[model samples]
Target: MLHVSDIHAYYGQSHVLQGVSLDVGKGEVVSLLGRNGSGKTTTLLTIMGYLSPAPGAITWDGQQIGGLPPYRISRMGLGFVPQERGIFPSLTVLENLTVAARRGLRGEWTLDRVLDLFPRLRERAANRGSQLSGGEQQMLSIGRALLLNPSLLILDEPSEGLAPLIVQEIIAILHEVRAGGLPILIVEQNIRAAFAVASRHYILSKGRVCFTGTTDELRDNEAALHQHLGV
Candidate 1:
């Protein structure tokens, strides 16, 4: 569903991604694993056109979408839920979701569908962003993204700043989304959350891909996992 080929990104003269490449097939859930400063987040930004790739191509469903603006890329069926969980502080939970919503090819991630996936969101339907707890805000963010009905979902650190129970809830919701046939690229530092959802894994080092394989392979190869991820 998505292909990133030899992509390079930089902030001014500081190169962040060096010929990084990976692919996510339809209905696949892929996790990007590494310590801090591994360029995993940079890869997602480049694909979404939030950061320009100096070299290499990002193609979605056989069409080139590398340099397109973030808005345009989003309209082309990509949804992003960053670590901060962007939400309008003044808007009610429903209103915030309505603002980021869209209709996509699958026609699956409707408001009702998302509400079904996250019943707690329905409970806080009338609450404003500022009124929500951290976990509630995260749920709102995921629901907002789902309303877009994206073919591919990019989640950066979904587990960050949440309680363990909330992390499990988020993981469960992600699995539900994956079962509905959306590809996902999860950039997370938490191994438990990543392992719970991702069937495939990629270990990055200094802006380059060091390994890409099944979760089972990564688990079995203790040396390789230790060499890069320190797992």
Candidate 2:
């Protein structure tokens, strides 16, 4: 459902993403894996238009989206949950979600369904974003993204800064979303979380793709895991 080809991006002459290419098919979950500074998040930012690619193309459902603004990309059915869990500190959980709601787009993800996916959010409906625990904030972030009813969901480091149990919870929730046939492209340093949800994997090294394979293939390739992912 999404394709990125030969993307090269930079931050004021410091190249961050070089020749990075990847794709996520309909109803499939793919992951970008690597150690810190491997350009995983750079790939995501470029795809989401937070950073523009110098020489590459990003396409969604066969339409080129390279250099499009983030709002435009999001309106076209791309949902993103950043590593920072971008939530409004003063807004109540419900408000944070309702503000992002896009009705009648995909029509499958609603506030009710998202609450069902994350029951904790229901209990914290009146809580402000800054008042929640780290896990609750993450849940709020994911729920807010789902309320957009995106055709493609991209999460950067969903498991970061959470407890092990919370990570498992997030992974289970992601599995449910995938079961409903939403395509996902996740960037994760947590190999275990990535393996739990994604069927395909791409390992990056020094701003370039060094490995691309199925889950089992990556599992069997000890060198790639050790070298690129530091697993």
Candidate 3:
């Protein structure tokens, strides 16, 4: 349901995403993978309108949205969970999720639904964001995004800097979300986590797509895994 074609983006005068292209189809989970500086997050930032892409096009469900503002894109049913897990440090866990909640046409994602998905959030409902662990904060971030009831979810580094068990939990939650019919475009440094949930994977190098294939194909190609992903 999302398509990005040869998008180029820059930070100041330095080009960060050059000719990057990929897609996330309906009900499908797609992973964007690469080593650091390979433009994975840059591609996402560009797609979400934090950075504008020049000389390329981005269409969601067939409408061009390359240069729209972040809020506009978000209101168009695109939910973003940034790499930093952008939660309000002073706000309570319940407040963090409730503030971003929006009732979609179907209202499939609700605060109770989200809390059910991450039960720990319900337990910490009264705790401030800064009082939570890294894993809890990550859960809060994902929950807040879900409360938007987006058509497509784009998550950057969802499994970053967490315990192994927490990573596994997050991966399981992603699978559950995929099963619930939301298409996802995920950028992950954790190869195992990406493989666990995404059907198709794209590896980037120097802001370009270096490889695109199914999970099975990626797993079988040790060379691509080593050369592009350092796996």
Q: TM-score for all predictions?
A: 0.95, 0.97, 0.97
User: Any idea what lDDT model 3 has?
Assistant: 0.92
Task: Flag the better candidate by TM-score, 1 or 3.
Answer: 3
List model 1 lDDT by residue over 1-231, tens digit each.
899999999988998899999999988999998889999889888999999877799999999999999988988989989778888889998898777763334566777888888899899999999999999999998888887878889998989889999999999999888887889999988987888999999988999999889989888888767888777
lDDT of each: 0.88, 0.90, 0.92
Candidate 2 accuracy as TM-score: 0.97
Ranking under lDDT, best-scoring first?
3, 2, 1
Q: How close is candidate 1 to the true structure, as a TM-score?
A: 0.95
lDDT of 3 at 14: 92
lDDT tens string, model 3, 87-146? 999999998988888433247898899999999999999999999999999999999888
Question: Which runs in model 3 stand beyond 4 Å of their true positions?
Answer: 102-106
lDDT (10s digit) by residue, model 2, range 110-170: 8898888889999999999999999999888888888888999999999999999999999
